[model samples]
Target: MLTHPMPDPIAFQIGPLAVHWYGLMYMLAFILFLVVGRIRLKQAHIAAAGWRYADLEDMLFYGVLGVVLGGRLGEVLFYHPMYYAHNPLEIFAVWKGGMSFHGGFLGVLLALFLWSKKAKRNVLDVYDLIAPLVPLGYACGRIGNFINAELWGRVADPSLPWAMIWPNVDQLPRHPSPIYQALVDGVLAFILLWIYARKARPRLAVGAMYVLMYGCARFFTEYFREPDWVVNVLGWDISAGQVLSIPMILFGIGALYFSYKFDKKAAPTNVAKPKQKHAQ
Candidate 1:
C-alpha cells in the first residue's frame, strides 16, 4: 500500500534556465561510471593491461555522445516512428524526455568501437573493461524515469504489498516497475557481472554476459512494466522491449559460445593475464 512519490521533475530553476532531476540523474550515472572506471583502472590485473585514467575520460566523452544521440533516435524510430514523423523537430527536443535503453546500448557499442580503434585496443577487451560498471549507472537512469513518473508499470493487484498508485496514471495499484528494474537489472546485474568480470575468462565473455544478463532482466521485467508499444508476432502479443532483447540474447549466446569454443586462451582465473598492449 505505497503511493508513488511523484517528485517534481525540475530540480531547480536558474533565471530562464532550469535544472532537472533527470539531467542530474544522468550526470550521476556518468559520474558513477568515471568513479567505477577509476577503480577498475587501479585493479592490479586491469592496471597491468595498461588502462589509464585519461583513457577512461576520453571514453566517457564518446559514451555521452552515444547515449544522448542513440537514446533519442531509438525512442523516435523504435517506439513512435509515426508520431515523430509528424513532429520531426520534437526528435531533437530531448529535454522533453524520450530515450531508449536499447538505443543507448547500441550507441555505447559504437562509441566503444571508435574508442578501441583510436586507442588501438581490442574492442572486446574494452567492452569487458566497461561492462561491469554499467549496471549501477543504469539503476540511476531508472530512478530518473521513476522521478519523472514516466514508464510507469502495468496494473497490479491491490492486495500485493508494495503495490503503488501512480496518481498521474490512475487510482489502480501498479507495480513500481522502475524500482524493480533498478534492483534486478541494475544492482543485481552489477553484482553478478562484477564477480564474473573480476577474473578475465575469455575475450568476449564478459561483454556477452552483460548482454545476456540485461536481456534476461529486461524480458522478465517487461511483464510487469507497461509496454510502450507492442507487436503481434505469430498471434503472440510481444512487447517492443522483448522484441529488441531477443536479438541481444542470441548475440550474447553466440558471442559466449565463440569466446569459449574458438578462443584457446579461455580459462577461469583469479588473476587476469594482460593481453597484448596496443599502441595508444
Candidate 2:
C-alpha cells in the first residue's frame, strides 16, 4: 500500500499574506468554468440561442456567489446545524473549512434562475448550457480535498494495489476516495456530459442528465469514502451524501421523463440546419 504525500496546505506566501492550495483550487474551478464555458458557447445550439461571452461572464459571477454561499450553508445546515446553532459566530468562520456540494448545487440553481430572469432566458435552457461545464471544476475541488487530506476513505483490502494509508488517520490501507471521486464524479461525469451535450436533446434533458450523473456518481463514491453522518431512513442506514443524492436521482428521472414526454422541440442533432438554401 502507498502512503499519502500529505502535501502542505499552503501553496505560497506573498509577503504577509499566505495562499492555500484549497483557495487556489477554488480559483482554478472558476477559471475552468470560464474556459469551458467559452467552448460550450461555440456549440451550434448554444450559439444559436444567442449566448455571448458577456452572458457567460455574468453567469460566472452569479455562480461564484451561489457556490460560496450555498456550500457554506449546506455544510452548516446539513452537517453541523446544532454546532453552528450553538456557536452562531462560527458560522461565519468559513476559513476553518466546511462546504457541501449538494448545497452549492442548489445555490447555483437559484443563482442561475435569477440570471435567467435577468437575461430573459428559460431557466431550463440556462441549466442545460451550464451543465456540461461543471464536472471538471468539481474535480478540482476534490483535488483540493485530497491535498488537504481531509476526506480520507474507509479501510481497504491490503491486496488492493492503489490502496493508500493516510498517516494522519491510521496505518490501515484505505481507499484514496478523493482521487476516486475526482476520476469518477469529476472527470468521468465531464466526459460523458460533454459528449452527450454535443448533440441537442429535448429541453431539460441535458440538465437532468447532469443531475442523474452526479447523483449516481456521488452515491457510488460514497461507498468508498467514510460517511460524514448517517441517517436512518425507515430501517436502512444511509450516509448523508447518499441521503442528499436520493432526491437528485429522483428529480433527474422525473425531469428526464418530463423532457422527453412533453418537450418535443429538440431532437438530437450534431449541427443546426443551414439558413441559406443551396442550388440542387
Candidate 3:
C-alpha cells in the first residue's frame, strides 16, 4: 500500500496572486493542443484541407471559453444544482474548484460548430481534426485532479500493488483512479484515436471513434472511482458517469454506421500519397 504525496496545490506565487498546479496543468493542456495541432496540420491530408495556424489559434480561443464555462456549469448543474441554487455567488468562485468533462465536451462541440460555420467547413470535418488532440489534454486534467487530490478512488484490496491511501479520505487502501483515468482514458485513448486518424476514413468515422473510445474508457474507469451519484435504471444501479457515457456509446456506433453505410462518398482517399521522384 502506498500513501498519496498530497503535494501543495499552489505551484508558485507572483506577489499576492498564488498560482495553482491545476491552473498550470490547464495551461500545459492548451500548449499541448497547439503543439499537437501543429503536428496534425503537417499531415498531407490535413495540409491539403486548408487548415492553417490561424484557424487552430482561433479554435483554441473559442474552445477555452467553452471548456471553462461549460465545465463549471456542468459541475454546478449536474452535481450540485440545489447547493448552487442556495449559494449562487459561489458558482463564480471557480478558483475554489469544480468542473465536468461531459459539460466541457458539449461546450467544445458548440464552440467548434460556431468555428466551423465561420470557417465554412463541415462540422464533422472539424470534429475529426480536433478529436485526436483532446485525450492527452484530458490526461493532463486528470493529473491536475490527482495533484489536487480531489477525485480519489474507491477502496481497494490491501494486497493490491499500487493501492493508495489518501489520508484526507481514510486509511483504507484505494485505487489511484485519477492516474488510471489519465493513463487509460487519456493516454491510451489518445493513442488509439491518433492512430485511427492517421489515415482518413469515412467523413464522420474519426470523430465517432473518439466518442466510442472515450465513452468506453470513461465507463470502465468509473467502476474504479467512487460514484458521484447513482441512478437507478430499470432496477439496475449505475453511476452518473456511466449513464452519461451510454448515450455517447450509442451515438458513436450510430454515427459510425452512418458514416460507412450512407456516406460512401466520404470514404478514405489517396490524398496522402507520397510524392515520387522522377527517373534520374
Candidate 4:
C-alpha cells in the first residue's frame, strides 16, 4: 500500500497574500479553455461564423460566475444541506473548499444560454465547441483535489497494490478515487470527445457524447469513491454524484436522438447556401 503524499493546499505566499494550488488549477483550466477555444475557432466554418476572441472571453467570464455560484450551492444543497443550513455563512467561504461538478455543469449551461441569446448563436453549438476542452480542465481540478487530500475514496482491501492511506481520513488503505476520476472522467473522456469532435458528425453530437461519457465515467468511479452521503432509494446504494449524473446521461441520450432524428448538420450563422442551378 502506498501512503498518500498530502501536499500543502497553499502553493505559496507573498507577504499578506496566500496563493492556493486549487485556485491556480482553476486559472490553468480557464487559460486552457482559451487555448482550446482558439483552436476551435481556427476551423474555416467556425472562423467565418465569427467565433471571436471577444466572444470567448465573455463566455469565460460568465462561466466563472456560474461555476463559483453553482458549485457552492450544489455542495450546500446536495451533500451537506443540514450542516450548511446551520452555518449558512460558511457557504460563501469557498476558499475552505467544496464544489460539485453537476452544479458547475448546470451553471455552464446557463452561462452558455445567456451568451448565446446575446450573440444570436445556437447554444448547442457553443456547448459542442466547449465540450472537448472541458475534460482536461476537469483533470486539473481533480489534481487539485488530490493535492488538498480532499474527497478521499472508500476503504480498500489491504492487498490492493495501489491502495492509499490518507492520514487525514484514517490510517486504513483506501481507493485513490481522485486519480481514478481524473483518468476516466478527465483524460479518457477528453480523448474520446476530442477524437469524436475532430470531424463534424451531427448537430449536438459532441456535446451529447460529452454528457454521456462524463455521466458514465462519474457513475462508474463512484463505486470506489466515498460517498458524501448515501441515499437508500429503491433498496439500492446510490452516491450523490451518481444520482446527479443520471440526469446528464438521459439528457445526453435525448440530445443524440434529436440530432439524429432531425438529421441537421450544424452550420454557421452566415453560411451561404449553394446556388440552385436552373434546369436547362
Q: Which candidate number has the best lDDT? A: 2
Estimate the TM-score of every prediction: 0.92, 0.91, 0.92, 0.91
- Local distance difference test scores for all models: 0.90, 0.91, 0.90, 0.88
Sorted on lDDT, best first, the list reads 2, 3, 1, 4
**How does residue 193 of candidate 3 score in lDDT?**
92
Residue-level lDDT of model 4, residues 167-186, one tens digit each, is 89999999999999999999
Local error of candidate 2 at residue 107 (angstroms): 0.6
Q: Write the per-residue lDDT of candidate 1 for residues 1-280, one digit (tens) a residue.
A: 8999888888999999999888898999999999999987877778888988998899999999999999988998889999999999999877656789999999999998999999999998899889988999899989988998888899999999999999999999999999999999999999999888777568888999999999999999999999988989899988988999999999999999999987867754478788998899
Q: Give the clashing pairs for model 1.
A: none
| Candidates 1 and 3, the one with greater lDDT | 3
Off by over 4 Å in 2: 86-89, 233-235, 266-280
Clashes of each: 0, 0, 0, 0
lDDT of 2 by residue, 221-264 (tens): 99999888998879987998899999999999999999998896
Instruction: Give Cα distance to truth, residue 215, candidate 3, Å.
Output: 0.4
Q: Candidate 1: global Cα-lDDT?
A: 0.90
lDDT of 3 by residue, 13-78 (tens): 999999999988888999999999999999888898899998889999999999889988998887
lDDT of 3 at 122: 97
Predicted structure 3: lDDT: 0.90
